[model samples]
Target: MATKTHRYRRVTPAQLQTISSLAIWIPILFAVFKLKTGDTKFRLFIIFLVFGALVDSFGMIIYYFLSNELFDYHEVFQILYLWYECLFFVWLCFFFLNFQQKIVWRNILLICFSGLFITEFILRIVISSPNDTYSSFIYSFFLVTSSFLSAFALLRIAENTGEILRYSWFWILSGIFIYCFSSFFVDMLSYTAIGRGIWSIRVLANIIQYGFFVVGLLKMNKAQ
Candidate 1:
């Protein structure tokens, strides 16, 4: 991703992004090392962590090697990965569904999230890339997902309201919520001129998200 124009700069934009990507390893490794295999919820999370890493790795390779080619393999990789991510979140939400009104709430939330994922997958099939209109849909998608996630996280924390820091589920859900909300803004601003600035913020938010994920894993181990 480095270019001649960026040669004069001390730290290129691509370099910064690459550096920030290192943060993703934290949660992945933490889960692998600290989280027990018997923990079903974290086991689901690790699946996504591994899957996302594979998708991004493949996308990066395609971009680096075949960017100038006619085929837009990289973009396809991104869209496919994003679509899977939406579904993953829905599953994640289901995994965290442990409220008092479980039967009613579970059915309702599952219906909503399933509908959203189906609609988004259909849109992805219709729209080829991150077009201007498609970007708006993506933004809205994240907004809705994040809102639901945050509400759930808050509800979970409310049970042991004072011990927020000790709740692994809260931290894990908070990280996902923050990432989704931040992604919503990133998609919102992707069409504008200040895209680079927004990209940096997104990168920073991603790094911090994984940090929160690591903390969550640690809390889970400690609570065990």
Candidate 2:
């Protein structure tokens, strides 16, 4: 008889952190876009995030009313969640073009995120629901990877300017750190009976993360 081998897959805490950081990007993207653009051209994107946020929150609210092992509503909620999830990457791409950096690595990262979005779109179509395929690896990867690089660049800029504390990078970095760390618990919570409770933490973290972005935006306005 031949021996059989079993393969196991795992997501590291660090990876989970990256994934969780995605929650904050929705609001951060909105704040930055509103700050940068004056016209109504990108207004639709802003509305998308707002609508997605509302849909996601509504889904959470309805989750509490669902019965065990008979979540007929889950299917509908998952569809909305998947759609809401796509907005983050779209905003990230828009934000990247407005970023202050002009380096080869940044360009490569932008390209990678764009490619990931395309892959994610296809995956969403194939899966069609969070229950079918909820990992959202590509989205998490893009958000986390881009955040890491952007945070580093901002830190460097802060250092070179000799005004680190005065710069917006400090707040942005702190927000990213908090958002990333919270993602691990959020992911674990998603699979448990108490998952919704943990997801509440994710919402709190998002609020803080977006607050930091708002602070950064105000700083930019002051510098102008």
CA shift of 34, model 2, Å: 8.6
Clashing pairs in 2: none
- Candidate 2 local accuracy as lDDT? 0.51
Best by lDDT: 1
Evaluate candidate 1 by giving its C-alpha RMSD to the native, one decimal.
5.9
Q: Give per-model TM-scores.
A: 0.73, 0.49
Cand. 1 Cα-lDDT? 0.66
Range of the 10 consecutive residues with the lowest summed lDDT in candidate 1 = 122-131
State the number of backbone clashes in model 2.
Answer: 0
On a 0 to 1 TM-score scale, where does candidate 2 land against the true structure?
A: 0.49
Highest TM-score among the candidates is held by which one?
1
Error of 2 at 62 (Å): 9.0
Clashing pairs in 1: none
